[model samples]
Target: DIRDPARPKRLSAVADSNFSFWHSASFNNDGTKMLFTDEWGGGTQPRCRATDKPEWGADAIFTLTNDQMTFRGYYKLPAPQTSQENCVAHNGSLIPVPGRDIMAQGWYQGGVSVFEFTDPARPREIAYFDRGPIDATKMYVGGSWSAYWYNGYIYSSEIARGLDVFELLPGGLLSQNEIDAAKLVHFNELNVQDQQKLVWPASLVVARAFVDQLERSSGLTTDRISAVRQSLTAAEQASGMARRNALTQLATQLESEAGGSSDGAKVRMLASEVREIANVAR
Candidate 1:
């Protein structure tokens, strides 16, 4: 859009019907979508309070089509804040989730939230980090001002506190493989306004991440886990079709046993990834 910076052109104007006040905006990789924030109350009041409307101070995701933007949906911080907490939606940036649309955002005292907007109509939060309000007695007018994902880490500019750094850890809503895949992206310069899409390379790290998740969740049996580790180790050291077949066979066995386990769905899921990894390794 800024092809001619000397005479910048305004392609669109989102008026009051969309939000009360627009604080900041970001574009997804590929520039196919744009996400805007509604800093209701000018970000100095408790706009994230229980009494506030979901759209009053939230991030709205919009898809770009034919040079036109269409409203998708809103992602407000789920946690309710008290009048004493100066909470409201603020700044955010994308988290590189291969094959998916994910973002890490800050909501003043509402805390840091990493979520998925792949399906703009229904965005979901995956991981988060927040502390007790700055002051439980009064509105402190302080919290996270910005949270952006760059390279392999998420950098947050705290209003009162100095800069803070965060890393994505495996959680209920996000798998380790997904997180690892995201980290493959590296941006030399990340200007919030000039957003860019993230692209991740396909590699063994992804497959190993899936193994780590299954190991942590006890999705695999002890013996199966050992076998999987061994096969993966040998395959990494091997450079032949036999290694690929070995991994494939292991994946097949895991898949076959998945339906019989309590965590069958997850097991089957991991097996599929492992299968793909074998093909790549071979």
Candidate 2:
């Protein structure tokens, strides 16, 4: 479904293959090429796993042309014989780096694998960070989900936890040295509680101060505030209780800030109030 305001067209398609179930798809930076996942391999059903027989062998990743969806090539994951259900690129994102040919793919239970797609037609796996071993038969799950290259690091969404950070380096296919070089920066280990304490209240206080300044400069009345409050209330309803409470608190602070006579003093007071709030919240 195209939910964007600029494009409101609905898209639908039919597949010929019974096993054809496109899980996720993404396009290149320039929208020239596209990549998609097909999870119809390794004895697994398209979306269900009823049979125990491992008839299907391997999940495949396919590259396609953006304009016509023309078949380009396929990257069949290595099927090592083990209790593990083999690596399947379930969901992934293309990182657009100027000099890099790497595409970060999320492998279910296989962890995050980076591929050197220099030869686009025949992409090769360069580095892989396995989430390590776990009880397979008991339903071993969890791996990289969404990944984005920002500030020279790959930020991955580890749905089971939070975010896992990694960095890429020069490497060739299946290079353990390259993979080891990439470190895992676990957010939880880095004083996450303290960080949250510092961030949440500060953000609310700053937002409140900004809204107050806008109101003062625009000479907005209670009627305008009521209208914006209504919109905010609707947004809160859509967002849920926690967000609504936070927003309402910010609005209340903004109202208080506007009551102050001096602009600089109001900002300073807001900052001080935020620090107090953070201390209490923490």
Candidate 3:
């Protein structure tokens, strides 16, 4: 089922009765359709241990229309258990490349499988990355959860570990050369807490300072500045340390840009007023 966040509308029940157990779903580039993963065959329950039944661990990706929520078709995973147990595509995302559709799906005990979805209805398996032998029976099994493309690199969130960074390269399907090039960097290994605390506030302050300078140089009206101030006020009202800190940083930037006893004297006065509000919020 899909819901329009902006409108009071819903698109639901696009699949047959056979598609009951599903773990995740992702939208195509144009937002016209979506691809969903079904964990088990029709009647099988979630996290089942019975090997007598056809394992039903095979994963299938289905395409559905966005406007009408109609089922277009499906692409089933090829057979043969690559690992100790059967494969299951759990959580994944679709990357939109011009003239091509790429899908990155999480496979329990199968790692991250990247598929070429040129034909939205029938996707082809292109490449995959398997971390190592994963005991799916174990309580604390590790695997990929979410995959996204940012700054020309594929960033995947590991179950327990932080983020695993990968870069796509030209190579065969299971080529270790490309995998070696795609290194995994641990975000938690860095100063995570400190970095998190500075990111939002730092961004807002820098942006506000840049805009203020540009406005001063161009002799533009204070309308834009006033809008930004109002934004900061709203951010301060948000019930989160990160938001309040960001608003405070914005206030500081306004104060710094507003110099003393000069053409910016009025701006300086407004900055002081904003600072007082920020101080109370903090």
Best by lDDT: 1
Write the candidate numbers in order of decreasing TM-score: 1, 3, 2
Pull out the clashing pairs in model 3: none
Q: What is candidate 3's lDDT per residue for 209-282, written digit by digit as tens?
A: 43343344442247755776577656745755666676667667667766532436445534554555455553
Task: Tell how far residue 224 is off in model 3, in angstroms.
Answer: 52
In Å, residue 273's CA in model 2 sits off its true spot by 50
- Which residues of candidate 3, in runs, are more than 4 Å off? 1-7, 41-66, 70-72, 76-79, 82-87, 135-140, 160-162, 171-282
What's the TM-score of every candidate structure? 0.73, 0.45, 0.46
lDDT for model 1 comes to 0.78
TM-score of model number 2: 0.45
- Which pairs in model 2 have colliding backbones? 42-56, 42-57, 43-56
Rank candidates, lDDT, best first. Answer: 1, 3, 2
Model 2, which residues run further than 4 Å from truth?
1-19, 40-66, 79-81, 84-87, 99-101, 159-162, 172-282
How displaced is residue 191 in candidate 3, in Å? 22
Which ten-residue region of model 1 has the weakest summed lDDT?
197-206
How much lDDT does candidate 3 score? 0.50
